[model samples]
Target: MDSKIVQVALNGLENILRLGEQESKQNGMGINPYCALIEEAYGLDKIEFLQSHENQEIYQKAFDLIEHYFGVEDDDPSVVPQVDENQQQFVFQQQEAPMEGFQL
Candidate 1:
């Protein structure tokens, strides 16, 4: 696979992760930028993450972040959470018909 694309994206993601670590510096030197620059180095680790293949871990991380940001989680059939009136619109719309076979 092409590596240049991976390098560019990893650089972008690293730059994002560096937003909070700007204060910690050692004589004006820090690992944040160094770590961020690893995107250009000859290695597959960063590439694999920034550019995931079919079974990449980065995909999972991305999904997790999405779920967290959306305040949603996988609904387990074995367990159900108590839903209040306000959440009915989100989980089950009051105007929508409930499935006949759905159990409480």
Candidate 2:
């Protein structure tokens, strides 16, 4: 896919995740389901890939997402976290139903 497209998708994902995190906290959920979705989708892989993107804005957005979710600095290689074919199917299964309310 085009880098711009990927960047836009990542930005949207980050926004949703950040918003979900805030709302979940307010609701006392203690965990962000959107973070789980990102994990299931191997979001860290995309972050790693985008780190080398020639576009500075893209890399910055990726880094910001990382920092927000992991509470880690950009130089922290340990926190950056993958999916496979079977896992892809499992992710799809989990996403089959749209979330109706604040329930995870």
Candidate 3:
């Protein structure tokens, strides 16, 4: 609804992407499928630890960071974060779904 809110959402995605894969290795939280936890992780902001090392190519740690520290699990719905309406606008070329009876 606001720029700060939107920015926080975007930043949260990055933080989850950076942490969830790692958190799963420990705690044995059993890979939550509805990953609203990623958003929960954002509120915690522990992802700040990752900001300095983001450019490195070794993503395993980054993934582990996500999986473990940020409470991400492979089966978690958050693992496949949804593209919000604003994000969908930028990610795909839009063509409306065809109606069943209105074939072109």
Q: What local lDDT does model 2 show for residue 12? A: 86
Would you list the rank order by lDDT, best first? Answer: 2, 3, 1
How do the residues 57-92 of candidate 1 rate in per-residue lDDT, one tens digit apiece?
545544443332223356985455455787574353
Which RMSD does model 3 reach against the true structure? Answer: 14.4
Candidate 1: misplaced stretches above 4 Å?
Answer: 23-104
Q: Which ranges of candidate 2 are over 4 A from the true structure?
A: 72-104
Worst 10 residues of 3 by lDDT: 51-60
Q: What does candidate 2's lDDT look like per residue over 1-104, in tens digits?
A: 58789787987888898898998999999788887787788877777788788888888888888778855435644442324576563222243666576666
Alpha-carbon deviation at 36 in model 2, angstroms: 1.4
Tens digits of per-residue lDDT, candidate 3, 1-104, equal 34455445545655654455456546586454224564565633444444344344323444544555455335855344445686564343456886677646
lDDT, candidate 3, at 79:
45
lDDT of 3: 0.49
Each prediction's Cα lDDT score? 0.47, 0.75, 0.49
Q: Please, what is the TM-score per model?
A: 0.23, 0.59, 0.24
Index of the highest-TM-score prediction: 2
Better of 2 and 3 by TM-score: 2
